[model samples]
Target: MANKDVEIVKSSGKRVKFSFDKLRGSLKRAGADEKTINHILDIVRDELYQGISTKEIYNRAYALLKGKETFLASRYSLKKAIYNLGPTGFPFEKFIGAILKYSGYKVEIGKILNGLCVSHEVDVLAEKHSEFILVECKFHSEEGRNCNVKVPLYINSRYIDVKQKWNGINSNKPLTEGWVVTNTRFTVDAVKYGNCAGLHLLSWDYPKGNALKDRIDRVGLYPVTVSTLLSSEEKQFLLDRNIVLCRQLIEESFMLDHLGVSENRKQKIIHEINKLCNL
Candidate 1:
């Protein structure tokens, strides 16, 4: 089969060409049914608008397939979609790492240490001044119910275990702080346990009370949105255009923009901004 060309505009406003043949080849290798592949392609073609990146097209296709009957089908579809897009997860890590570095912290990625060895790699380790922080990043469309408990357990097994080992080494170094950052909200019990254990948890939804933000600020690891991190010029452009591009960009990049921003809070902010701008 011949490659089908598509044009994508980058963030810098440069148009780059891509091909869909690789995606079709991947689907064929994955043994996807013809009907499904055609459906996905049709949806992508119908939905993708001007200036849409290949990554955006894939994300849209993934969201479309997620409504299907079989979980495996959805997973397969998403994997193919991501392949069509490009590298995503590590970019998110780097973005978050940059934020920490901006705030005067040393950031390390995929560091291996003498920890509990929880069977998975820790995303980022950050140190500032004299305090150590362990960050675990989860980049998923939606976090499951166990997402909260799982993070604490991983932190306890990894960071806490590493600290215990460190104590054995020096017995004087300070303990590392634990932080869990996810694309979805944390469970109520998870929040309660995290607070009690002095572990910092940041997620899509900030609990109703002031405590969550307070804890984040005090710990010097406040939740940051890509929107917040963007320069004033970018922010104004986003606001002026009412561009859903920010959300689309984050989704395509597999980044967490919804984290720490709840539906209610988002609505309120949009409302306030609209009122002030009289838009």
Candidate 2:
């Protein structure tokens, strides 16, 4: 048992004492059963050391799970997979569009809509029923990055501008809500301002049970980047072909064949993706 809190370094170079509760919570959230959780915890507890990085801890736990339960590892890597979608923010935008599209929203990505003051290229535009939502995706490659109040403040202005432009066109569906989604968490002040401005803010773990993580879990919409069987280049190749979601990958499984993937390897990959699709 880990009797004392272990100090660990984060990817952003911040140092903090690790909490077993946090690790346990993550495992539980990833759908690990109680027995598997305890087994992994026991093993990780034995290897605890001062100055171990969070990434190292995560890899240790992930490796343990991957050896036993493959899908659990993919689900556990949810946060990291979202991080892998970025560095350009375009794939992340496509990801958000896919999520919204699956949720019954008509989604358009990278649409250049003219605003009242100036033309703006919106990341995502979703129309469902009488509600049209403008979503701005904020993606960061580093861990522990926080989107601040300035982000919502800026996005709100952009949303209002676009809403005004559409309002003048006599469209049936009106822009109802503006959302700011990030792969990381938003600052307290950012959430505060968002709530005040009626902007729906989404993050990896924000909004309690209705976060981006929850939605992904609910919809079983794992990104192709979450595939453990596929290499980084393969994932990127799929992403470049706009096969961002696992559902899209299933539809475009021929892409794997085009990449010279063997039949047996393809079956393993399809099986892995099917497991995630059922998540």
* CA lDDT of every candidate: 0.50, 0.90
lDDT of 2 by residue, 69-140 (tens): 787899999999999987898999999999998889999999999899999999998989877889999999
lDDT of 1: 0.50
Worst 10 residues of 2 by lDDT: 1-10
Query: How does each model score on TM-score?
Result: 0.42, 0.95
Tens digit per residue, CA lDDT, model 1, 22-84: 556544433356787787777666665556765576566545543542222333342232222
Q: After superposition, how far is residue 22 of candidate 1 from its true place, in Å?
A: 42
Q: Which candidate achieves the best lDDT against the true structure?
A: 2
Please give the TM-score that candidate 1 achieves against the real structure: 0.42
Point out the worst 10-residue segment of candidate 1 by lDDT.
78-87
- In Å, residue 152's CA in model 1 sits off its true spot by 1.7
